[model samples]
Target: MEKNAAELLKKYLSGQCTPEEKAMVEDWYLQLPFQKKAPAAEQIEASHDEVLDRLKQRPKTRGIGYLKHIAVAASILLCVGLGFVLFNRKIEPMAGLAKKKLEDVLPGGNKATLTLADGSVVDLDKALNGEITKQNGIVIRKTENGQLEYIIQDDPDAVSGTNTIATPRGGQYQVSLPDGTKVWLNAASSLTYSYPFAKNERAVALQGEAYFEVAKDKQRPFKVRANQQIVEVLGTHFNVNAYSDEPMQKTTLLEGAVKVVAGGNEVRLKPDEQAKFNAASTELVVDKNIDPDQYIAWKNEVFAFNNEDLKSVMRQISRWYDIDVAYKGKITTEKYFGEIPRSANLAEVFKILELNHVHVQVSGKTMTITGN
Candidate 1:
């Protein structure tokens, strides 16, 4: 029975489990108590023993079926606990993983820079909350909650110029545009727009990634230009990821409708649909019925990966942690699926990755990944 349990666990790890078996293993894992912090070295073995004993005491029923499942569950818990300990020991030789805590990299926060029409820059991180500046009948204020807000004043004679807001690596920011549109910029992203907007339309240019809640104005359509693609909408909620490092630019719509135009091709996206544009091919593709929440998870302070590839996952980590990633060996093709808080330190995030056979070594502002 023990040998059978071990075999089942091995199969589960190697992605060979049948649907029912996979569900069973995952259910058992999810039922385990969540640990707020890593367990001490002394508690490791004792905790393992207690959990194993509890699983073993379950009454036998329906021949080998009941006992077989209990044994498998015990093995899964044992393997996970042991893997955590072994990974810590292999990564660093320190007293009970204490050294790892000290070397951890903290997560990102609200940090950005605002560039006025005259090209003067203000570091939002250092600037005091309240009226940041006024230009051409527009009042720029940094709110108490650290958000940037624009208040438009009546000045028909004023000529509005372009203003830009940018966030550096390991940073993010929220801004309310002059037209009442709210945008949340992710790390290493920028948004540029004219204050007071144009008389005919409301338009903005984006780089990197941002989530937008457009203000309703039937006469003036809102458009976002990124990566040679333009997303046009009347009033909608959507997200755009147009990082130059990425293979494709994606525009995801959460509500209302949007049309993505690129390279003489256009695709209209309904709610919960995503339009992907690849610059290399100059082709646009539309995917329907995707969960919009996963794309905007970062805005909500969470890292959500839905069967995402390793390189893509690392790209997100690199931007948010302000680290450079290099591969030592052939990258694994394994797809990762999970949600980790954006607030977790680098070490905690790496620990989760290590469990899935993706190892990371941190040095200064760089991270090296080696696949098992």
Candidate 2:
């Protein structure tokens, strides 16, 4: 197998890298042994961050796997090296961030749920915003703004079974927990709140998709139980996307720390980091490069894809607008990188794609993608 710059650098770093990765790195570094630097060289300086960034990513693409994931550990360690060269460049400043369209969002999709302490279930997608038919020992109140708020007063003895709040196709909702923890539920997701709720610790069961801004309570930790994995925290904000369609479940931390437990393995994630778990393989991965703006786009009411592709982007649009997407293989290996406001009309969303030269035709609720 041929090795790239990433592979070469990993091997040049010695046994510091895994044996499986050494070959790829050795090949790339061997090509530039005499030059000592990369072919696409940046300005050389210890004080410039780009220099350090190049140094860090120099060998990252060399077949980085789960076993080697803990290897990179984000830019925390490389900050000093990156700081040496970054923030000192005399380049022109740009706008902070602009709004994006509906077609933009990271792949892997989202989740949400509707709960009844009695165990009876109501799919959020099928349920209307208003009075949900009452069940045993519980009252369901759907806000006009489309947030599902459940109130349980009669269950003094604590219910045994869990009441699930799930979102179906073409659905999205938000929840403000009693503790003031705001959760945004994406399409086709569900979460179960503990019965009578924990007195000391505020815990909840989650599946599909949800983002949490946990109310700070040091005395009682907030626990989110997802498929196969458990996210434990006291007071922190993070996003968990555990869609059943995909074999992987991901938890991205925007602020505060979170411990992702998957298959007896535990990985701690810091702020601005994401932990991706493969359920089929029972593997845990850590991606350090997180764009909070991109991750929290839904919160701010926008669609943002950092560096996503056509298929991935299409799925996101389907979830948000509740549409079926069809595309031919003509647009193979094409990438879309842009943002659009969520409030924009569907036409506006399609315009972004047209501008990128991806011929798209939208009719009613169905849109097809053709051409690269």
On residues 1-372, what C-alpha lDDT tens digit does candidate 2 reach at each position? 222333334344546655545533333223221234433211122223443455556543221121122222111122122211122222221112211322332222223445566446666555677878555445566777667665666655544444566666555668766566788877767767754456788788886778998989888888898889999887788999887766568898988999899977899999978898998888898888766556667666666654455677666667766677888656745444445555555544554443223455545556666664
Best-matching candidate per lDDT: 1
After the best TM-score superposition of candidate 1, give how far the Cα of residue 11 lies from its true spot, in angstroms: 21
Which portions of model 2 show Cα errors greater than 4 Å?
1-140, 150-161, 199-202, 218-220, 246-248, 355-357, 361-365
lDDT, candidate 1, 117-213, per-residue tens: 9999999999999998988998899999999999988887888799999999999999999999999999999999997889999999999999999
lDDT score of model 1? 0.75
TM-score of each: 0.76, 0.61
Error of 2 at 170 (Å): 3.3
- Model 1: runs farther than 4 Å from truth? 1-103, 355-357
User: Cα lDDT of all candidates, in order?
Assistant: 0.75, 0.59
Q: Report residue 270 deviation for candidate 1 (angstroms).
A: 0.7
Q: What is the lDDT of residue 323 in candidate 1?
A: 84
Report clash pairs, candidate 1: none
Error of 2 at 96 (Å): 36
